[model samples]
Target: MAMIKTYRRDDDGVLHYREAWSEKSGVRTHMGAVGTKGRTRFHSTRSRTWPDKPTATEFLDNFTEESAADGYFPVPDDDHGWLVLQCWTFTADLSHPDDQRLFEHGQDALDEHLGWRGVGHYDGNDLGGKPPAGYDLDGTVMNLFCKVVDTGLGVKVVRSFARAFHLTPYHVIATREPGDDNDYVLAWSPRKRDKDFDLFRL
Candidate 1:
């Protein structure tokens, strides 16, 4: 519990006061150094509490928040009726009653993004490819990637990299049994249904 202060050496060789934050209120207050001599001056960032932990979904939608802070998004689009501008991250307003639309439109935007070019793309790019420009890698990108696919495809893509992407089973978790794992309960298996299984590789 030491006091916070900024000290600058004066021409007289004595350290002079510059700034300090009191224990109460915790706001940064600056001191005037005008006319007073100091070799250099610097201001420390104000101390802040660790941000609240967000649910997985909240963390993923950060791109939208960042975009909104930059003066777009939360704007209304003409055809789509939401502020649907393209950015390194999406800026979707979840104010509507229909939340699933976020997933639907978000996927459409991500699909058209240059990063996912070519129809042949698969697990690796979705999991390992460069994130949208200017954005650092974090769960946000993966979450958005997860939403890019329609439900059937999304379930499959999410499976291939369950370990690599560090994804959990989520809704599928409670239903899964110890000996088996399948995102789609009806997905065909050779041993389970011999005649329906494809014998040759496509």
Candidate 2:
């Protein structure tokens, strides 16, 4: 079972908890801060001495709930998956007058302008290579793929991209991966399929 263990710092008597769990690779632990005498909430990772053990435990419960709501889970012991910081899925309407530039200029123009590489639909070619037939940017609905900066900057990046391209981000989600740091791959597509290389889910 996953648990949060509390500890008091020897130097300052500050209380903190180490949230850890068993994963396929090994145990994964994350630290939480329980502030000093007057501060009851665990705001961020900072040194704080709790008055007693019960206070630390109470804060642990709150931290666990917040972590869960943020889509953080114990690294699975079996399926080798990488954590997804944030994913934004949206379709650009090529018919829109303002968005018609995406269809007129094609993906090559976008790639050159935004420094984005093209990922083929049939084959996993995502290095600015040519996409497979019928997957070009000539369709009425074009998919936009933007590399997420990080969890903290994901939403801002997505929204900025959407505004620049006159598109809308319909879906956004964050995930935790247990496998390699480079395992999470990003790709754009108009049609959704199970075999698509970019379709990763927890």
Candidate 3:
């Protein structure tokens, strides 16, 4: 999945938004007033004159820096008073080599983003008979973390975060079981079969 970032600025009380993301062809950006149709442009790494940015990821990283320097700030996660969910992933089940690769890829893709929180492990045994809070059954693994930025988009952020691991939305587990809509979990398993990715209900 492509990684996206949104920036905002106010000029004389008028608000504008700018969004940038890494795409298959290169870097894409959109900018306009908050409620209007935006203008977009694409830049190819080789075709553009960005001397220091040779990769889409590098281009996006620099784009973010330049946006900040230009007085454009990241849109506030709770701008609309939405409950900002602090979400984290369970460690990937690393019994399969593919799972390890997916976990690493997701981590690397998200670690630098502003929404990324810190990662740590919970002592599953210490949770008083509760299972470890992660994808891996083993409780000792480190969890990757992120927040539900743009909660108004309703899970888009979470889905993109999961897609980085080659996992789909079905792999997401919420912090609350059954009916409660809460945080997210990225599920994984050593079993390669699709059925093994089923959401585990606590």
Candidate 4:
């Protein structure tokens, strides 16, 4: 699960958000999600207002829904723009005081984004009890992860398993990185099936 630093605005309709991350020393750096929310004034170029205090799923849904009112994620943007479903796949011992909350928001922000999109859909005995309080969810896996990403992005995560075409709930996984069977990262893309590099508009 890739941790995403989503950008948001303040209550006054000023964009302000911060990404909570864990560093190598287990220390964290809560950088502004949009950077310098203070210096920028409200009479600004952009203003984001989030009512209902929507969760992650709701956040993405609201964006798409609002766009649909105008009509759809906004072209290659909604459909093809970088969904960037991010996460960190590190083996950290958060039991340390400093590290405790360093990566703590990882789950919070993650659950918020995915839940708001009505994703986090889980139905299996493997669930390790219910999600703790103050959080929108608890469990984590590939399939459940997909529901959140695909719903938010409005596109299908295509994978193998011919009979089960839409089986790739996790379009992108935090595998140190996504690569071919040989574990090569340089040659990856949505067009995994072909070599048609149209993203640059050649």
TM-score pick, better of 1 and 2: 2
Question: What is each predicted model's overall lDDT from 0 to 1?
Answer: 0.27, 0.34, 0.43, 0.27
lDDT of 2 by residue, 70-155 (tens): 54443233432222212222223335554454446434443332222111111111112222334333323223333321222333
User: TM-score-based ranking, best first?
Assistant: 3, 2, 4, 1
Pairwise lDDT winner, candidates 3 and 4? 3
Better of 2 and 3 by lDDT: 3
Query: What is the model-wide C-alpha lDDT for candidate 2?
Result: 0.34
Report clash pairs, candidate 3: 90-134, 90-135
User: How would you encode candidate 3's per-residue C-alpha lDDT over 1-202 as one tens digit per residue?
Assistant: 4655554546576555566777775787877654344577978874456555468777777877887877777644444212212222232344454445545554555443213321111111111121334343432233333343333222444344455445532233222222235333323333344232112233
In model 1, which regions exceed 4 Å deviation?
1-146, 168-202
Q: Which stretches of candidate 2 lie over 4 Å from their true place?
A: 1-99, 104-141, 168-202
- Model 4 off-target regions past 4 Å? 1-92, 95-98, 117-146, 149-202
lDDT of 1 by residue, 23-106 (tens): 332323333232222232322323344245443234324434553454322211111110111112122233332323434454
Worst 10 residues of 1 by lDDT: 78-87
Compared with the true structure, model 3 gives a TM-score of 0.37
Error of 1 at 50 (Å): 49
Query: Least accurate stretch of 10 residues (summed lDDT) in model 2?
Result: 117-126
